[model samples]
Target: MELAEKLFHKSRREKLSSMLDENSLVIVLGSTNVARSYDDGYKFKQNKNFYYLTGFNEPNAVLVLAPGGMEVHDEKSKKIKKTKEILFVQKKDPLRETWVGRRLGYSNVKKELGIDTGMVNSKIGDVVADLISRDKYNKIYISLFDLNFLTGEVKEQLRGFESSWITLSTNVQIMDVNFLLAKMRSVKNEFEIEQVRYASTVTAAGFYNTIQMIKPDMFEYQVQALLEYHYKELGCQDVAFETIVAGGNNTCILHYNTNRNKLKSGDLLLIDSGAEFNYYNGDLTRTVPVNGKFTKEQREVYQIVLDAQYDVIKKIKPGVKLTDLKKYSVERLKKGMQKLGLLKKGFDVTKYTLHGVGHHIGLDTHDAVANKSIGKNDYDKLVAGNIITVEPGIYFPEDAKEIPERYRKIGVRIEDDVLVTKYGGEVLSDSLPKEIEDIEFLMME
Candidate 1:
């Protein structure tokens, strides 16, 4: 890792350490590689929470933090030093590296990751249990993870120690570290904002260049392939999530990733995808005409979603409540649907316009932060440095007999990543061509 990134992670740890109460210990586990099939494993992905703290990208690692410094005996230097952090990583295995990948051995971890002390991860269970048994700390903070999903030498070793660990936990207050990290991650730092902004920029290129190539008779998966190709070509290795390339009636199904169907001439194509830059992610959605010209029905629905999204994005600023934004979005969609004769004045708008207008976007797309309760209160109020998606969608299923035939099976959603600033919301994806005329011109070219 680069010095700048390592330092940034160090600062994050220090900040988190400050948030912890006095005489408390926090333990966070990194992700382990999972087997894909026989004799093979999927690509290893580091835990986002662990990466946020340590910037180490290996499997079966554990991070231990003590708000109050603890004495550590350095085996190499034969000196005793005080430390607030300890990182336990895998021991080097030359044969394993030859078969799989290079290992940043435990001995070199402190120097490489800017961590205080480094030990072989196999000792984590015993080491942690012993620490807890000593009963020096008042509280122990453990990062929450479902044990059934975890697999690794450390996890297996910890499983053996569960009885003792549970016994220790019964005496000390055990806290889930997610809430603290969630609060810290909700507000993006300068580096995080830049990464998210650049991710969006790359995603826009994927959309702009690929959308022009999308024509009738193409399978939905083909469009998904082209978009992902563009993202990787721009140096983004992984997508924020599964690329949704729903076309025709499939567009009405939220989270539809069945990209096998061929797109028809008069149908609309909705591409909801983003790229992950560094660790930050960008999220965006765009609906366009498969034939490069929207029909009268399609344009009306698109305009409604677009206007509702624009209004919601405009309201993103520090101190503004997301609930209020949701309320306003509902009203806008309801009014537009009423004018189109899709609904009566008091009819439930949620039947057509589903989901919250947006969500927090960062390390994980729809980041680990709360989707609705984004504030300190239950109704999350926006705060400066919070980057969220402003997505307003209107869906009319094919089977809905109450709606107009022309509008049936149509889904229109306009989404953009917006940075909540003290000044107001800044559209990180402002460079994208979302205006109807702009989209038409791009497709025509």
Candidate 2:
């Protein structure tokens, strides 16, 4: 079986046993795309939540598990559960296969996906009705919103069952399973970590290729194209997100993705981009001088961002709160700004310093998870095997007249993917040239 298939079964079993009530039925549905016209159609990626649970990457699939029928009494006075994992996938369509590609048919899915049973999608309505017909089940656990494809079918099945109909009239439960899956995916397993590492390696290679091809007169989008081309050449199907190739003052816009400006000799180029592999992503940002060497002011601000990054890395160990790390980066940035005279002595750092120092990185570039509060002792502590990015930046717009002329129109950010560990945080993207001297050397070479 494939690695993704194994992960899918394990995650599904864990979620079913942990989240479902003793006599509840759970249904997980995926999205589908309908044809706009007779000839045109849209492609669909499997829902991340559904894919996490079943590793069924195909569209138009549903997973059903019944908690009541899954339990068995053990001689040791324990109730051993035997949850049935059923996958309903699209039936084999020879015509469609010729146009698109062959799907893992029902028989292949059962053997390869490690599911107890497999059925064609056409039988989903009846199967769901039968599962709800069992009076022992008092509640149904299904994803409430965003799964529009199966909402009507699910509601129809519930309405058809007499017991469910009676319960719905009064107060039968319809529990939402989204939060349960979110919590499960928040933590990274060994396999997930390895996949992220591979993504990071591919992203770093893309960055290297970009550096070699970049010239002062080239457009920012050209640099972006270079990185993306390398990403594809190295096997990444797409970028983790829109590539940020902001030049000069444009870098001040943190989420800048319109890479249209022309690179100049004195301008600093900020490239914040990543590559995705197997749905895992790597986020990396590096600001370099377009002329292959930073001017005095650019170097000063760049070094400060570098120092802030180093400070966060030095203290990022198990048990450190993310909030503390953010505070530490802010303080370091403030101090660095004061040293360069960009900020006045005792000025509030919050006015200039914005955006969080880091975020969880994985399936999504801005991967969703619970965030920690600043100065709060109750915040979640850093744990080993967690993958995150420490991105510290300072943006000074061209119009800002508060500081030296040399420093104006400068935006500097240094980012790297890190793996939290018991001993310390390991920098996964250390291959990128970040140090002032090292960056210059790489550019010149």
Writing each residue's lDDT as its tens digit, candidate 1 over 279-310 gives 78888899999989999899999999988888
Task: Compute the lDDT of residue 297 as modeled in candidate 2.
Answer: 84
Largest lDDT belongs to which candidate? 1
> Candidate 1 has which clashing residue pairs, if any?
375-380
lDDT by residue (52-107, candidate 2, tens digit) is 66777776777777755643222223454354666778778999989887777766
The reply for model 2, stretches above 4 Å from the true place, is: 1-12, 34-43, 70-83, 148-171, 345-348, 372-379
lDDT of 2 at 150: 47
Off by over 4 Å in 1: 78-80, 146-148, 370-379
The lDDT values for all models are 0.86, 0.77
TM-score of 1: 0.96
Give per-model TM-scores. 0.96, 0.86
Query: Model 2: how far is 286 from its true place, Å?
Result: 0.7
